[model samples]
Target: MSSRDPAPTVSADEGVPAAAGEPSSAAPVEPAPVDVPAPPEPHRSRAAARTWALPVGVGVLVAALFTLYSLAQWRAYVVKSWDLGIFTQLAQRYAALEAPVVHIKGPEYNLLGDHFHPLLVLLGPVYAAFPDAFTLLVVQNVLFGVAAAVVTWAAVPLLGRVVGALVGVAFGLSWGLQHAVDAQFHEIAFAVPLLAISLAAALRERWRTAAVAAALLVLVKEDLGLTTAVLGVVLAWRARRPALLWLTAWGVGGFLVATRVVLPLLNPDGEWAYGSRLDLVAALSDPVGLYDPAKGYTLWLLVVVTGAIALRSPFVLVAGPTLAWRFLSEESGYWAPTWHYSAVLLPVAYLAMLDGIDRARRGRVRWLRRYSRYAPVVGLTASLMLLPQLPLWQLTNPGLHFAGLRAQAARDAMAVVPDGAVVETDVGLMSYLVGRTDVYYLGNDNPVPEYLLIDRQGGGVPQEWGDVLQVAQILHPGVPFEVLHARDGYEVARPLED
Candidate 1:
């Protein structure tokens, strides 16, 4: 077996190297296996980056566009009405350190009496800084519109990024757009955004953020605070321990601040009392109830019921609690049933509807799966068919069209009057216009003026207007009255001496 000199050649079977120049059947093989390092996981890191970035970018972009659109529309429509005058007068009053006492005119405008909402009073500072009503409108509209979009975006779960983005867009187009762009009511626009932020905070389990949002809600309208507090408690219970503690602290702090410092300061008169008139039962039972079916009751009810069910979702506990409170409280017009209230709930409702559809798809029940598949189609068809019939809904409300016409009439009537001349109006909006803060509001049982401007095209005379006219007839017995202008359900009457 030995073939070479120096060192004898080893046998291949022995696992030794053969001598140089001699070929062996088997070469030295690798040593017994040992541990080695693994390759880097770059793919996993890349996937995680994608998971978060997509949702965030989409959410921001959608919100920005929606807000811009609404603000532009508000700028166009707001100046055409006399609401600008009310805002302007109030701003001027605040600047002059004059705080007028708000009387109990009815459930609708009672909140106007005492400056109970310090948040609204902040408008004083805004007006003071800008001194331009149009500028203020643009800024407020843009801010709230963006808030609506962002909050709606936050409503969708990260798992359903597409649905979430759609929800933001849909809500902005629906409730947010209607109020911010069409009606241009500040209360509605602002509430929508606050509700959105509240939704986002609840989902994140950030107690401080939720509490702050709830606090802002209270500022918008008082009763919303109670609803928000109850929701906060529910969220805290779901989160447990440290989170609960923070939530409790926030709840307590907010309650104290709102009740002690803010409410008392703003509502000095404490005359914005709550009563049976504004009760939820009354709002529901009244023939002239706020929720008219022709306008959009099915959509509204669907939103409420679905949100309640969505509360049971394991993943949406935070949003669920807050939404539940909104649903339950909104039943009462006094609590939060105004058109603005809808803005807060729109995103939540959309989220709930999506959840219902998803649940139906995953259910064991065959009927449910079939129903879920057809539900969207059915809803869409119904909405389109019913949408054309919506104009009838506006007619049911006798006062809505009249109110718009009256505002227009007030603007035109004010154009001819001297700056300091007082013009009595059934409502206060006209007084605010034309820089005539001293005008006697026909409300509060005040007597009519020698001059009476009645906007006939506006609609049936307001009870207060009738009262003013009755007094004018008695006081100025044979005075000649001239009709200065007339159009669109409106007429202006001024007294002339023979």
Candidate 2:
């Protein structure tokens, strides 16, 4: 049986005692009230965790993939001489605390005087530790990966984690980025992540952060100051802030000073060689010649793949200066997809696309709202379709082996040459020798080299070198030379005794 209920209190006026097991005709005592708060929701915490997990995971995965691929290329010795060699030598000089000069161009051709990129000095310590071209390759890939991560972070708030992850993947695998990675290092590597962070901050209306980030672009390249100026204009117009408009004006002013006054002062040539192509009217007239049709098609594909959403955002304006610079330039290389020229544009395009999608979701237009839901799917599909065309796929082919007997022999041949020797080599071998040897390109108008190195079967050396060796002659036919080593398309010769 249940315990008996407490007996009611009896009134004193009643003056009666209650009988055992019987209730009195008095009121029962009331229990005191106590406050108890509800427990927190587990689902809310789980949802927050899920929100960040996908984009972060995607970012890490893509970065790892690109890094591995680039390292593989480095091991394969597939990287070229013109840029990678130049940068590696400059970095080596910085590491040694010497003036950053390049002998590949000529003895004592100061890199600082060539381009006002003081930002490269920061990599000096890193190069000291690693001391190879591979170090630069890995660093560049990591910088780009950081950019992809930044884009992912920016996208998650607007598009949700899943769609944001897709955006990150698309951006990391984009043609511009892939080409830049395959093409070796450039100053633009620093610009990519900086631009991404600046744009991401701007999108969130973090004005001070955005301004600081944009302003730092001047350190990357003088021309990038113009891009920063355009960003300032975008921010000022969008937020209606007068102070931001002044930022825009200052950006332009800074660009002029950096390009016209400062760079000229530092440059040995007393002028910027890059400024020679500023004829706007001529560039506008023959637009067809400025860009390849295939590249033009890719640009069109990029827009359509995003459902043309990029065009709807003001961020698209950031792409204008870069595009105009490329098209208007007399250099045909700028118009092609072969280099890092277009890499800077990828961040702007994708960020603008994301912004447009966000705007579409909030607008009253019904069709756009529906289309916005499928934006990630469209982006992913387009990225996947273009994957086969990328350099990463070439790794799978057996022809691109990193290690073999012939390669090892060539490497051994390069090693036999002592450090600090004045040598002339083909374009392909110049990079390997740049840091160790006073190497020069084997071409017409070359000074008489003390030693001649060539790849006979590879056909990289000039045809004239073959006749010289056959005739036992040097650049100065009067200077006799002795063959040092000749094997499997690799040949090294030195000046003979008098």
Best by TM-score: 2
Task: Return the top candidate by lDDT.
Answer: 2
Candidate 1 overall lDDT versus native: 0.48
Residue 224 CA displacement from its true place in model 1, Å: 1.1
What TM-score would every model get versus the actual structure?
0.58, 0.83
lDDT per residue, candidate 1, 1-498, as tens digits?
456557764433464556788767655654555556898667977876764464455545544554454344332222333444454555555655556332222212323443234465666666666664454455455555466455444544532565455444444445324333433335444555665665566556666665576556656654455545555665566456445444445545655565555555445355333222244564457645454443355345434434333433432432343343343333443233233434555544544455556666788888876766555444334334443333223324435432343445556765655555545544333423324434444333433344454443332345453443343554455655666655444355667665
Error of 2 at 391 (Å): 0.7
For model 2, name the residue pairs that clash: 481-496
- lDDT per residue, candidate 2, 133-162, as tens digits? 778888888888788888888888887776
The residue ranges of model 1 lying beyond 4 angstroms of the native Cα positions read 1-92, 95-115, 129-140, 152-162, 175-188, 242-271, 278-338, 350-412, 427-440, 446-452, 459-471, 474-490, 493-498
Q: Would you list the C-alpha lDDT of every candidate in the order shown?
A: 0.48, 0.76
